[model samples]
Target: MFNKMSIINKGILTHSFKNINRNFNKNPEIAYTIREKIPSPLYITTPIFYVNAEPHLGHLYSMLLCDIRNRWELLSGKQSYFTTGTDEHGFKVQIASIEKGYDNPKKFVDELSLTFKNLADAANVKYDRFIRTTDSDHYDTVKFFWNLLLKKKYIYKGEHSGWYSISDETFYPENAIEEKINIQTQRKMMLSKETGKEVTFEKEINYYFKLSEFYKDILKILEKKHDFIIPRSRQDELISELKKMGKLDDLSISRPSSRLQWGIPVPNDPSQTIYVWFDALLSYLTGAAYPSKKFKSKWPAIHLIGKDIIRFHCIYWIGFLKAANITLPQQVIIHGHWLSNGIKMSKSIGNVVDPIDIIKYYGIDPVRFFLSETSVLEHDGDFTEERLFDSREKLISKYSNLLMRSCGSNFDIQRALERYGKMNLSRIKMEEFPLFDKSVIEEIKQLQDELNQLAKNIGKSMENFNLHSVTNNFIRILSRSNNLFQLCEPWKLGELREHQDLVIYLSTETVRILSITMQHVIPELSNAVLDRLKVVRTRRTIEFARVGADEAYGASANRGGDHPITRITKRTSSYPDITIKHQKAS
Candidate 1:
């Protein structure tokens, strides 16, 4: 019995996966207990992207990870909502508008926002809502939230002075700023050690949030939920920061409108504007349609963000929610940055990897596969031409070649022979086949069990929001299928009259299983491969065999689809043999 279990927040099981079978004869008690639980609508969000720069590989990387998780949740029968957009309101936008020679801040942000939307579209990144901080409703939502804090006595007027970094849109204490000489200007200046950006001493009167009051409560929440942060490393970092600061300072939540004229005006005071961080963090609730009937189902959310902003999301955002009597995010998934050939990506260094360019040259699925499959989410990954080529080569030769040969397509076997000419292909073949040998059946059964186990592992990882583990499992299954293909030469097995159907059955089924799992990470490729294998729309799940095993492929004499997925001509191309060069910033 393969039970489709209903999992709540974390690993709280409303239904069990142990009794998978629908039948009652073998396990009556388990079947009776397997009542279907209403699928909870899942709300997932990415930090609204800043409109200061064009979308880069780092942006795409974060979006891709979130998009993949959302898609997987949907496939698993959960109603998932994914929201991503531009953080349009900030002092940074004002500076960008002036530099770009735009008189209207709205017009400048609109243009930059469209570029990000276009990039997401080009990459096949699916999202339910594209929210901008400048959205009209967002102003109301921010004000509503601010009023909630004020009503609860969590906000008050305050005067403060600190080292402010305009680029980071954050104020730092004296200890956080270090004196440095500007390379371009050749002048001594103070810069923030954390962000490496120039900071200026500033004083202003503004509204402040009572972050210090919630410090003890936040520590208790951390202790109660050990896995509140997706990776334990990020949780440890946040806890350490909290302990180091015996108490949190009250956070300045507004800026005087006289100095920064670009943000949302404070709820009642026209002279003051809501600070950027405070304004941007509320976009999550606004995007979820908070303070409305729809929000109840989506109050607590799962956020996916880059590791750099962990403190803001984990500490500041959580404290703000606690103060306002709002639900905190269920989980926060943090991933490391993308480096360009062992160096931090920067515009001045001119090494920022444009995901748009990568998509244009390598296609969308390949780029998604390269990023998700090759890179570890816990640590930074280097983006080099050679690494991209190496990943592409593996996909083409091992996975794609297996598909082509199994489907009896012209798979450039001569090229494959040249590449592996040294090793004897027959040595890898398994012995004794009554077509589907007892051992072969066991091996395939083992593969099926692994997929079932993956279903469980993926569920647990999603609960913890550990996408790294999910991706590694996807790669592991793909590797196992490729190994099985080598051991059983399906092309050679197709020669025998008795073994032909069984060979096709085994090969096509394996590809179908892989295709189903690949749908979330590389959807276009998954669909194309599924179409080639002729697996029906209904049979695209781990329990595919139970639903419609016979209909996995058509009875056509030529099993291959209309066109080969990977180009035979480009099969042997060298790595770093990129199809096109980066022409200009996208």
Candidate 2:
């Protein structure tokens, strides 16, 4: 329900205060002439979750990835639009509702979708729009798209007889099916090797799209845009799969209304409804307000989807867009699945990891961090409490603890400064201070240089959507800062007065830089750290200038510094019943 303004314009912080030290003006603003200058909007989206069950780790992982990208865009001074929602039109949803004795599918989906919405809110997945395939606007949008494809002579009526998987809502070729017996039911059935779902021979008169026509063109796109798929391995897999197919089959775009009546109906065909996948994919366009001004710039979005659905997103999605004369997505990022301790999650096995329960037990930030940092985008990741705890322990021991201690020491220094009088040590030589080591100053200079290099690398990694590297770089800088603070022994140099000022300045400034750069991943902790330091600035920009004597002394002298929050709350501390650390120790 977020307004466009909130989604696109709210998070980019504007620096309110003037530069304290007027001497630093290395980069100046440029005056612009009207030449149709419009900043390209950053459009980020996740594949909407199917509303057949409660939100799980897989859903949360996708949402977290999108949220992280949107946050980085905001930090980079881009107008970002992030959309996530539920895919409500599917046979599974209809069956679940009926079997649960619900009188109406709408009522059932409405209540269930709210749980997802609530979970999103609880996890701080701030999306621009929570689009549902069942929305009135979406129905019109899907119908319009279908008609356009028909007008282009791409859609046609055809009788399809094939092995269909009701669970996957997909038709499998004969070679793709394997005969298997249900373990519990002990009945012979045909299963799809790709999806591990039972398939049956079904015949139906359905509407189909000429997906075969786009094979060569899709190959050309893949050849030209090497980065169309995030990891090269996935792209190669897609190309290999496509090449092996030889020729594409015309994809069925609708199901008989008698079989699936809960979806958007084909225009002028009450006897047929749009296929669930087709109906769901168009949610992106509807959420972007397609065929309108808003759609013009953001037509092609960056789609973050799971690797399992790569065929639907990369292949079928592209064909639809090309037929409609719409620009294809800028990029498609395919992430791997989350295995529960190396085992595939299944309801029958009772191994599905509930994300909400993780949030409730260990707090929200830990869950977000674990999923994003631990997973390898190209392969499956094992989600274990032990891994989560280890990640938490590292973040706390290295980053959070450093921030708290630095701020605490700075507070003490500020208190002492207020009790005595103002001290400006801008022009004083490092060696002039009592008991000051020249090596420490050299080390600080080296740290400044390292920060500059790391800042650039982090920016590049983010542009490439290398979040794991971005996070690793940030942590490296933090670990360096912590090392510097420990080596300098800032607290022990309190009696040296000038030496104490130097140590406090270096340590607190390191914390300040971390507070600014780490804001995208950990907003709450960053805000608290920034509050204590009183070093407010625009989030759009990152500067790594060496702290000059004047700037450091001025920040220390300012009364704006105050104790904001004394300590950061750990995710594990609140949930004593949850043994996130015990497993790690074992």
Candidate 3:
């Protein structure tokens, strides 16, 4: 009983916000030109990988997300900039260099950095810039930011005392302390693996950034931009807890010069070195050509990061930027950690899944698709080989089968169009056919409206970084489309020669709808739809709308009621079976 017009209006309302145009400039010069015309530029950055260890699936997950968003922005014609790279500062790297028998920090870090570069390359991330904390330009930028903060009185020399985890490169509060028995040492210790060490009752003088001052400001920002932190629940819980705490202490921003001297020197203070977090987080700006005229044009758009490090990205990073009077990023998309067998994957466990291993087992596309589909943008999600296999079978197989079958066995683009065009001729004169269902047009419109609403809801979830809901909605839509196809029995109609046009019309329209629905998640599949329809690339030109009323045989009035002879073909055996083989050699 839903009016088709009302449904259309509702659908439009739901998805209208998602229609923001992206200005993609493949050439940096062209991107600069486009930046001048755009109201705002979108800058994105991935967390810099520490060079102490090799890249893992968790690292790839973060980078791939940035890549996906970058690609989407490009496809939408947005002037987008993306960055990813290595954090080469810290005692760990210093110790690692010595342990590797490399006298020079640069040489040791460079070797480790290559592993990250190769991993990113294998993942097909088209980052505009790859930053290395050791880069002279990056060093200057970090120092400049630090000096600016210091001049603004936001930084001070202070004595810091806390549990520092070298592994996590983080300090833990009293609450985070865990009493564990060190079997090897035969002693009880309050330790945090996240910090990579036990709490020693000691204090040291170090540079500190005054983050507590912005507690209220951060809260206000969160309130104003509810969508800034995704998976509303995580944002709500995290922000609420912070507000209750009322204040945060200043953060330590330096490492002892004697212990590790391979980092950027503190401005006007050669004896002190910038902390790991300070240098690493600054890569976001440095990678985007910050302080340069080009960087001023495009500042911060969205920051994609793992949930484990949300505190640093969302809190400290924002505080630092605010202290410097710089613009905060539009959004911080926090994704949950990927657990293997219900436990965090670690080198000690020998359970860390290398992204390359998965890529070698599958192809890049399948691995990318599986990760994106399984990752819940705001909550912890499990990553298993079995889950990846199932995703491949369900999403890839079914989707690919739909494409091959819909376009016919020949796979010739021109032939498929011709066949579709012929069917459209019959549907042009629907009034003349006695058996033609006129009410079906209304049903199709209603369904389109429902699809629009679903798309809008999904878009909002995506905007808020609630990828779990996005995947859930995607699966629901796919199920509905499959059910609708089964009930319509377009294959049966192919048997009635006279109704051939009607079958083509319904099938093409259904395919169009399915194709448009996939634009956000599986754009590769959507591209296939555009190719099949032979439509020229145009902005906001949906696949479903490309096939006009004339092409829809159901709308025709000239077609006779007489049924034509069914031309049966062996090729029309349900859907094609798409085989997905592992890329790894047996």
Q: Which tens-of-lDDT digit does each residue in 363-470 have in candidate 2?
A: 676667677677578788787766777776666777667755665524454543343223333334665754657766667667666654555666677666677886
lDDT-better candidate, 2 vs 3:
2
Query: Sort by TM-score, best first: what order?
Result: 2, 1, 3
TM-score, structure 1 vs. true: 0.83
List ranges where model 3 is wrong by over 4 Å. 1-38, 173-178, 182-186, 192-197, 409-461, 466-498, 509-586
TM-score of each: 0.83, 0.83, 0.77
lDDT of 3 by residue, 461-523 (tens): 555545556566656655555554555555565444344444444444455555554454555
Superposed Cα RMSD, model 3: 11.1
lDDT of 1 by residue, 169-213 (tens): 888877678999877889999998777899999998989999989
Q: How much does each candidate deviate from the true structure in C-alpha RMSD? A: 9.9, 9.4, 11.1
Clashing residue pairs found in predicted model 2:
none
lDDT score of model 3?
0.64
lDDT of 2 at 330: 88
Best by TM-score: 2
Looking at model 1, the pairs that clash are 1-20, 1-21, 2-20, 2-21, 3-20
